[model samples]
Each structure stands twice: as C-alpha cells, then as structure tokens.
Target: MKSSFLKKHFTFVFFIVFLLFSFKASAQKVRPIKSDQGEVVTMHSDILKEDRRILIYAPKDSANSEKKYPVIYVLDADNHFAQMVEYSKYLSRQDVFVIPPLIVVGITNTDRNRDLTPSHSNVDYFGKSDTTANSPYKNSGGNEHFFQFIQKELMPYVSSNYKTQPYRIFAGHSFGALTTINCLINYPDMFDAYIAVSPSFWWDQKFLLKLADKKLKAGSTLSKTLFFSDGNEDSSSPGSPFHTDVLKFDSLLKKRNIKGLDFEYMTYPAESHMTVPIKSYYDGLRFIYHQWQLPPVSDEKLNPEIVMKHYKGLSQKFGYLILPDEAYFNDLAQWLVKKPATLNNGIKLLEMNTVNYPSSSRAFTALGAAYVVKGEKQNAIASYKKASELNPTSNEIKSRLKELQK
Candidate 1:
C-alpha cells in the first residue's frame, strides 16, 4: 500500500510543477511576430532607481544595413506597445501613408501613479482630502523623476543606439496622458507633439487645467502640435460634464487666445478608457503629420542619389506595383523639372510612372517632354506618338507633336 501511494503522489507533484513552469514561461514570453522592425529590450536604469523594460519599434528599413527613422516615446509601454507599433507600420504603408514612417519607444512603468502624477496631493475626487493610514497619495507624484529617467537615461540610450531625428512625440492615456499634458504645460519644448488621450482632469481637482489657464496667456506663442481626446465612458447622462471635461479644456485653450498652438480635440462616443488608445493613437498620428498631403516643392525634392539608393528596397516593399495617379505623379514631375541639369533624373521619374501606369498616355507624354528638354528629339517623337495613339481625342497631343516636329 505504501509503494502504491508513493507512485500516485509523485505523479501529482510532477503535474503541479509542469503547470507552474508553463505559467511562468507564458508570462515572460513576448508576443511573436512574423515580421518586426522592433523588439522588447530590457534596460537596467540606475537613474529611475530600478531596472526598466522598453519596447523599441522602428521602420522595417530602419533595421536594414543603412537607414534611419524618427522616434515616438510612448508612456504605458507594457499595455500598448505592440498595438502602437503595428498601427505606425500599417498607417505609414506606401498606400495608406498619412504620416512619415516612425520609430516607437514604449517606456514601461514601475510605479504608474507615482511617475505619472505631477504633484503629490492628498485631494480626492469628492473635493476632499485623504488623511488615511495608507493613503495611495503617499507616492502620488514623481513626474520629475520619471522625466529624469526619460531625459537622462532613455533619450541618451536611444540617440546613441539609433539614428533619430530632432523631432519626437510624447504619447499616453489616462494617468499616462496626464503626464504628457503636464510636460506640455510646464515644459513645452520637451517634445514636438503631445498626444494626451483622456487625461484625468479630476486629478487634484483640475490642477493641470488651472495651470493651462495661467500659463497659456493671451497671445502666448506655444509653437507645438497637441492632440487630446476623451471617450463615452463619461456619458452617464445627457448634458453631463463627465464627458465634457475635454471640451471644457478645449474651450479654455480657445479662450486663452494662445498663438502658435496647433491643436485638435476629439471625443469618442463609443470608446472607454481602456479602448480609446486603439483608435486615438492612429488618429492622433495622422493629425500631427497632416502635412504629408501637401504638394512636393523644390526644397522638398527627393535627392536622386538617395532615391536611387533606396529605390530598389522601396519598390520591393510596395511589391513593385506602383500606380501613377494624376495628382501624385504630376507633383513629382513638377518637382523634377524645377532642378536644372537633372534631365536624367526627370527621365527616370517619368519611366517609373510609365512602368506603374502602362495605360497612361500622359505618362508617355511627360517622358517625351523631358527628352525634348534634353535635345533627344528621336525619343521625344517616339513618346509623343505613343501619347497620341493612347489619347487620340486630345488636341493638346496633336499640337505638341506639330510643335516638336517643327
């Protein structure tokens, strides 16, 4: 009987150990990706007085032998890092591109409340004070320390490790969002863009709100892009101030008569605190980089050498299926024509368009025009003939051919 009992007990112990090990392994493992431009790296920071974990996501090209990208520093990295990285990649895809491809630096938190809050205050939501034996506010404010970690430790590490631009963005939600807002109100020059999704306006009974009222005086030049938002979780009843806090903040800024402040506010009627980041992050990114749709000017010209260097990779990335739309290609052609002694580059751009849009008569015509400018009459005549054949009804094509022949 004793021998039988020992065998059964040993089996049970083995199963328990197996279960525990499985759980531990699952907790430590990061999510798997088929293709990724970023990885989760741990940083042992003596500055924050603790070992910190950071998730760094970059453009796919950023990892290639030679490339660089701008970086966005995100708060609450543990919860939202992968999602933001995926969003950045998909949105900045060649077709859906609304913003420049960017790197994401997600900063994981040790003490979320402590590091996110600006001031150590005991004030509660009811407009009363907390004087308990174990008040949560005991470690309420550590924004300065958190900023130190980012500025002293994180920034240097990223700059030294990655090729980054002077432009950077700070993004967060809830308490994390409050931290971003605090940075903007107090240290406006800290970042290029500030994305605060539903910051806790209830914090210390509108501490940051009051600060904005005071600091953003009439016609103050706060040259920055700020995008903030709230969600429907605050919608308990009609005409309630619960969800109107962001609106109130928006109005306050308008009333402040602040100049050089490019800002936009959005309210999600269906999103709650936890879910707002999914949509808000994508939208905020687009809002900040809306200049992408503007026409490419002479100064905005793509360097031929740089274009040639990255062209093959870029073509492969877009699956070598580029289409020359009238709007986009025309702009590129105008940019190319402005540079003297770059007819070869101009011809190259036109050829790219022809390959993408083989059916486009305008593409051939543009190619012909560039050849004519280079005194290549034979090539120009061939292109003009093709253009006339493709678009036989166009009187403009006939006029061009007649003029070129003379």
Candidate 2:
C-alpha cells in the first residue's frame, strides 16, 4: 500500500509540472495573427511620432540573405490591412509568378484629417470657408508634418528592421488618397507607384488640386506609376461634396508631357467609396506589376502534338469541367517542342498539378506530349483526342489531331 501511494503521488507531481509550463507559455505576449499560407506575418511598429498605430507584413521567405522585397506603404491600415496582406502573399506565390513577393507597411491613423489634408483651412464641404472657432478645421493641415514622419521616422525604421528593396508603393483612399497624391507631387522620388483611391479633392476648397496644378512639372521625367479611382456615390450636398474631381485630375495627367509618368484612373460605378478598395486594390497591383511577367515562348517551342496532352492534364487539374486558355496551351506546346530535355521534368510538375487539381484536362494533355517526344506517338494521339473530347471547342487540339492523321 505504501509503494502504490508513492507512485500515485509521483504521477500527480508530473501533471502539476506540465500544467505550470503550459500556463507560462500561454501567458506570453500576444502577436499578430499569422496569414493563411503561413508565409505572411504582421507586427505592430512603434515608429509613429503621433498617437497612431502601424502594422508591417513581411513574407516568411524574406529572411533569406539573397532575397529582397519591394515595400508597399498603405494608409488607413486599420481598414484594409488583412485584405492587402493576403493579396500580396497569394499573388506572389511560386506557382502564380504574377509578381515578386513584397513587404507591406500599413500605417494606421490617430488624427486622420490633420495628417491627410494639404493645407490648414476651416471650410465645410461647400466652397465657403468655415470661420467658426470650434470648426474641425482647427486641427487640419498637418500633411507636410506627417510626410516628414514617414520620410524621417517610418521609412528609416522599416528599412533598418526589415529586408527591403528600393522599389516602393504608396497607397491611400479618400482623405488618405489625397495624402498619397500630395506625396507624389511634393516628394516625387519617395515611391515608385502612387495609388490614390477616391481622393477627397474638396479639401480646403480644393487647395491640393490647385497645388497639383502648380506642382506637377509637365516637361520633367518623373518616371513613376500612379493609379486612382472613384466609386458611384455622387452625392453633392453641402456636407457630402460631389464634383468629378478625379475626372479633372485624369484629364490634367493626360495633357501633361511628363516623360515616363505611367498613370491610370478607374471608375467603379457599381462600387461605393467603402467597397471599391477590395476590387481596385487587386486590379491596381496586377496593373503596376504587369511588366514583371515571365517571357513568352517562341514558335520553335510550340509542338501541337505535345501541347495537346499537357492541356488535357491541366483541364483535369483546373477541373475537368474547365479547359486551359489558348495562350496557356500555346505556351506549354512551344516549351515541349522547343526544349525536349526540359520535357521530362516539366511533365512531372504538370502531373503534380493534375493530382492536386484532379479535374484538369490540361495536365493529361501535357503528360501525352511528353510520351510523344519519347517516341510514343500513339500515346500523344490519345492525349490529343482526350483533350479535344474534354474541351470540344478547342481548335488547336482539333487541328493538331488532323495534322497527325495526315
């Protein structure tokens, strides 16, 4: 009895120790929630001089010594931080190849109006300036000071603390939109891309608009990309000003002879000021990085017989119900015919994609192409026929089979 009691006591002691360690671990400081892919992480930055919060998102692979990432600074981070974080991570995935992975710096706000507007003026949404003592304009017109914080404090802190490249993007909306455009005009070299989503052109009786007119050098080579947009809420009340100010700015940009200044303006009539960011942000990112795509395949690489098989597998992977686009099929065909040595490994890669996406007919088509190059013409014909059956309307596959028959 004595021995049994001692044994039970030892077991109880072990349980107590485990509980203590688990409790200690649970009590550790909280951090930002990790992104879905586990490659993205966010953390709060204590670099703002004002009573504001900031968040930074970096790719997990950013830790590699040789890898460098472009930085994107977003305004009103409290609202759009998560969406932008996921977009950056997924669009830059190894399989996507749309754009390079990027570091995202999201700056939250304390005094949004004071930091975003250009000049100090107490004017209501109407053209009449407000002269009242208690007007909200009392705390307005602090954008220049805020820009200094970004230049002197935030940028330096981020560059020091993270692995970053020289390329940078500045993004904002509404009042924040005005802030980005103002930065582009006043401090031209701060960022490579300036994204202004629905800027408040009515601020200070259009003080910034007038500043833009005087500021933007028409003949100079600014060498930057700028994208801005607006939603459908065209309310022109005294409090809710609505005059197509974005349109005016768009026209001005069009008339400018500024060399190397790439710009785009979008109007989402279906989306509102609140909802446009979701769509516009994705489109804007794609647009800015459009030139970063992989090189296209040449005619020598495009073997129709080999490409047809690959298309079958891809269709199965994407879902047997859907088929590969003409461009995608054409590129793969070119690669298979032009580079037979690459076919062996590339075929295996397509097989993995097919396994992951079992319904993709494109994967099967690719597999057939590899077999054909290996002197398995019959297998190639089978693959081409399967691709044609899966996607009956595919003219490329049909033509390929007819040539082989002849």
Candidate 3:
C-alpha cells in the first residue's frame, strides 16, 4: 500500500511541474526594467521663505533594516545629482565594496548666485565687473542665510524622516564650489567633509582665499576632509586666474598645515570646466575613504574577530558605531564552509552574525545551515526552531525543522 501511494504521489507531482513549465513556455510577456529612481521631496522652508524641492537616493538595503547611512549634499542637482547617486550606488556594491552605503541629498537651487556666494558683488568670472541692472550676481551674498536654511529646515527634515548617520558631506561646482569653501570657513561644523570642483576662487578678487587664511589659523585644529580640484579653464597659459587661484589656495593650505585638516588638491589640465566633475567627483570619493577597503585574509586566518575588528576601526575613524552587514557575514560564512579546512571557522562566523543580529530570522537560518554542514543535527534543529519562531510565516524554516526532527 505504501509503495503504491508513493508511486501515485510522485506521478501527480511530476504532472503538476510539467504543466507549469509548459504554460510558462507558451505564454511570455515583454517586461520593462524596474526603475531605480529615488524620491522627490518638497518642504516649505521658513528661512528661505519658499518651497524647496530636493532629491534623495538611499541604499535599497536600508529598507526594513536598522542600518543608518551617511549623507552627501549635492549642489547643482539638475546636473550632478544623478552622477553622485550613481557613484554612491556603484562604490558601495558588494562586489566593489570600497565605501559604505551613502544617502545622497540633492538640493535644488532657487537663486544660484544669491545662495552660493559669500560676498555681494557685481563682478562675474574672468574678473569682469558687470554693473548693469540685470547682472546675475546682483542677488548674491545670501550664503549665510542659505546655510541657515539647510541647518534649520533641510537637515532637520532629513533626520526626522530618514535613518541617517552623524557624518555629512557637502559638494559643489563653480559658484557652488565657492559656496562649499565658504561653508567650510564659516560653518565648519555643518558637515564633516567637503568636495569643491573648479571653484570660482577669483570671485570678488579672491575673497574666499583671503578669508581662508584668516579663519583657518595656522596650526589650528580643523579636523575635516576637503577634496578640491580645478579644470583647464584656459589655465594652461599665463595669467589664468582660475588655475592660478586654486594653486595659490593649495599653497596656503600647505603652508598653514592646519592640524587635523585632511585635504587633497588636483588639477585636470586635459578636462574643461564642464567635464572635470566626472573624474573629479570619482577621485574625490575614493580619496575620502582611502582606507575603507578590508585587507585580504587567507581562509586559514579569516575569523569573525577579524571582521568585527575591521568594522570597529572604521567606526572609530568615522565617529560612529559601524557593524558588518548581516548579509555580508552570512555570505562569507557559507563560502568558508565549502572548504573542510575552514569549516569550523565558518560556523564561528555564522555564530557572530547571530550575536550581532539576534532578531534576524535570516541570520538564524544561515546559522542552521552551517550547523547542518557540521552534521550537528540537534544544533541545526534548535537554530531552525528559533528562526521559525522569529518568522512564523517562513515555510522553508518549518520544513527544514520538520525534516531534522523526523
């Protein structure tokens, strides 16, 4: 009777699988790719007295997870927001894990000149003073108020609505770059790092340069990261104030040698003002997290302690409590257990994930699989039971537990 029932059940299961495959093979649909776009948000700002539009790109992994991400504020969102979002996504990929997942906030401009300049001036780039009634620089020198808008409205909104780390980065180009440097000098505590691409240092006859010397006192402690670069801008020949001004700023930074001021300066002679941001932003991000990559470890030496210690070092450097992602540890452990030499070490790695994320059903499920590899059926049963309790709807966990019990 048992043999007859088994034969019939196998036939029925095979017939059902065949029918499903045949249906899928006969019917097909052209599918569009899922959009990988971020959210567009608008908030009314009392400081600016306008409805500010912004773009936000957060890591997908942040959803339904307790992970918090650092933020980078991008100026000229119309042009550079997508680029920074792509950089943040690609650099933090599992395969190319050089930096942590970042949340990018692209701040759109209401008045470009008024918000991005430090001083009121009718002068334009190339040292030409446009004193006409319609000068673009007429609405300039509201940078201090711009900073207030960010601090009072934008930053608070992001913090209240999203999971964010304490570290923040400010980035810009041209006039926006000038604004970034001005923020560094005046509102130093607003952001931890700053990126400036081809800043109009010649604005107001080198006003920011003079201010940098005065505000950034010699040997003072301004423990911040700054990456500034300039493009050709016809700077190859003599009397190119655009390139010369940046060189002078670099000289001043080197001369002052402000304590704890980590900075880098690069000049891209081949690139024009319009094209330098491509390479400049990429290199700037790499420079910011220069030591973020984990050192290579042989399987024999790889252990949970080493992984934990690596993240701890990063936490100290970034002034936040950084922990290894649960998925990363689970993958590493599974790979380790594939080889007999590292089987026990792999189990240890899985155990560490449980300690770090006790409430995670996935972590517990992974640990159970590692125990199964070691032929510890009782331990595996216990792990699956805990996982099932944490996630009662998981049929896979229930089936695994039943199989082990039987």
Candidate 4:
C-alpha cells in the first residue's frame, strides 16, 4: 500500500512540473528596452579656437515633420544636458503638453573658469584674492569670447542645420548662470529667454551686480523671459554671499522697472547647491511657460475654432508658429465626438490636423475612424484609402479600407 501511494504522489508531482514547463514554453518573451537618445556633433569654433562638442537632442517624433521647434542652449552640457532633454520631452508630451517641442543644444566646456566668468579676476568665490601661479581662477574672464562663439558660430550652425524657430533660450548654472545673466544685460537681443540657476554673482567681487546696474537703464525694454533662482547656499557663512547676491540682483531688477521683462525669482531653502538644479530647472521652465497650458473649455462651447485661436495667440506670445500636437488633437477630437452636438466640431479639428500634418498616416487613420462614427461611409472610405496609401505596409489600415469598401 505504501509503494502504491508513493507512485501516485510522484505521478502528481511530475504532472505539475510538466504543466509548468508547458506554460513557460508557451509564454512570449520580451527583451529589455534600450534607450539611446541624443546626438553628439563636433563643430569647430573659430572664435574659441577649439573644436566644440555639441550635444543635440531633438524631439524623438520630430523626424516625421518639417515643423520648426524652439531651441534651448544650455551651458555645462556634461552636467545638465540630459536633464534638460528629459524635461523637454516630458513637458512636450501629448498628455502633459505644458511647453512646445524643443531642440536642446548642450554646449560643453573646454575651460570652465575661462569660458564662464565675466571678468578676468584672481578673486575667488569667498571674496578672497588668490594671485598664486596655480590659482583655480587663473584662466578666468572669457565670457565675451564665449558669447561671440555662441552668437556668431554656434547659433548659426544650429539654426541652419536644424528646423529651429526664432525663439531661443540661454540656460546655465553657477558661473554659467553668471554668464547667462551677463549675456542678457550686455546682449539683450541674444536670446528670447534666460535661465540662471544659482548664478555665481560673487565672482569678481559682485562685478555682475555692478554691470547690471550700468546696463539695465531706467525703464529699459528687455522684452524677454528670465527665470533665476538660488538654493540655501547660506547654510554656512562660507556660502552666504551666493544667497545674498541673487537677492540683490532681484532687487535691482524691481528697481529698474524694465519693460516687457517677464521674470521670476525663486528660493529653495531645503536644497543644497548640488541638488538645487533639478528643482530649480523644473520650476524655471514652468515659470517661463506659466501661461502655456490651454484654459479649460466648457463642453457646451467646445469648438475647434477656439482651439485654433488659442494656438494662434500662443504663436504670437512665443514669437513662433505653435501648433497643437497631432496625437493630442486626435485624442481630443475623439473625446469631443462622443456627443452629437460636438461631432462636426470634432471632425473640423481632425481636418485641421490633416492640414497641419498632411503626411501623417496616423492622422488620416484617426480622421477615418471619426468619419466612420459619424456614419459618413464615403468619407471614411476615402480617408482610409489615403491612410493605406501613405502606409502601404500597414495591414490594419488595409483591413479598415477593405471593410469600408465592402
């Protein structure tokens, strides 16, 4: 009886193992997703007299269209490039849609002190003069040359090579922040926007503060957006000036009464210098594009014309032709078409997309699906046919067309 019982138990265990093996064999496998984003381009700078390594990150979906996008030129590419790229990606996503798509050009530094400082000085951050032979600030004060390189060589190269809009942003941190603010003061027309995170205003005994006083005249017109912020650098006496200097700069701007200068100053007490950038950058972008998101539309008055007008106003505000994302338009149209009252409005929105994105198979597919719901059989068939022709390899589009034809 014991031997019989043991054989039955072994049989049951083997059956369970067989079933597990069968399930494992039948299941589909998935590989890990590898993300290799951005492109590295080497460009020679005549003014700087060195080959500059430029890290360029365009919207991943931008390859399909000839649309131009705003550009952000970030100083300290090695430290901040990828972070900017990711931020741009998330903000410009179809769902989030806070900012328009951007082309981020990250300019790396060959000489940190030389390129980022505004004036040649042996004075360190702590208001102490170091005239030693091996001082860290020996090669300082090349901000003018750096700006020349950016304005003359770098900007032109990016503009010519990439589909870029007229609006541009200059972003930096620490001495890089000082450089950006200096550029804004001296070269106001250089960029449409400026972002200075924890600018090293203590450089050269607060030379930038003095310069700002001189350059930013009474009621001068800046006509630009500037977002600058600082962390709790005053946690110790050694770094207190960083906090105070930014405060002074903010006060100067308020006193100057600069016209058309949309700016914001933020303070992050919990963050240290090293960690402040992440929060500062995120908030800076939000501040720069504070009024970017579309206002809520009532379901009763939901119409494509309102959407169109909103984007036109955005284009005017941003100084560029801003269009709604194609995917978002499709999703919005589908949502709008749920009620009979807004069906034609939804159709009109999709039509606007077809006009904006003439070559997108997905756009046509979406339009066709909308037409099908509207019971416009002929229109749906024609839209499906166009989509299939655009994407000949798409069996799904072909199937839709075939069903519509039948």
Per-residue lDDT of candidate 1, residues 131-218 (tens digit): 7967777788899888888888898999898877667899999989889989998887778789999888888777878887788788
lDDT of 2 by residue, 1-406 (tens): 9999999999999999999999999999988975443222233334434354678887764212444578999899888777788889888875575666778888877778788888887876666666777776788888888887888777887899887877789999888999999999999888888888888898877777788788776787787898888887574243454446888888778877778888888889888878989988887898787755434654444343444455565344222332233224334543654466666545544554445434445656666666667667787787678777766887877887777667
What is the C-alpha lDDT profile of model 3 across 1-406, one tens digit per residue? 9999999999999999999999998898878987565899988888888888999988766313767899999999989999999999899887787888899999998898999899999886666888788999988899999999998889998999888999999999999899999999998999999999999988888899999988888888998999999999965445777888899999999999899899999999899999999999998899899878768988889888898899899888888988887777688889998899999988999999889888888888999998999999999999999899999998999999999999
TM-score of each: 0.66, 0.64, 0.89, 0.88
RMSD for all candidates, in order, please. Answer: 14.6, 14.7, 11.1, 4.6
Give the C-alpha lDDT of model 2. 0.72
Q: Candidate 1's C-alpha lDDT?
A: 0.77
Model 2 error, position 13 (Å): 45
**Highest lDDT, which number?**
3
Please list the residue runs of candidate 1 whose C-alpha ends up more than 4 Å from where it truly belongs after superposition: 1-33, 62-64, 124-130, 236-241, 294-406
lDDT of 4 by residue, 1-406 (tens): 9999999999999999999999998896988986545899999999999999999987756426677788999999999999999999889888898887789999998999999999999987667888999998899999999999999999999998898889999999998899999999999899999999999888887899999998898798889999999898888566467788899999999999999999999999998887889998888888888878878987667666788788888888888777767888888888877888888878888988888888898888989999999999999998988888888999999998998888
Ranking by lDDT: 3, 4, 1, 2
Q: lDDT (CA) for every model shown?
A: 0.77, 0.72, 0.89, 0.88
Q: Give the clashing residue pairs of candidate 4, or none.
A: none
Q: Pick the TM-score winner.
A: 3
**Model 2 alpha-carbon miss at residue 391, Å:** 45
Model 2 alpha-carbon miss at residue 237, Å: 4.9
Candidate with more favorable, higher TM-score: 2 or 3: 3
Cα deviation of 60 in candidate 3 (Å)?
A: 2.6
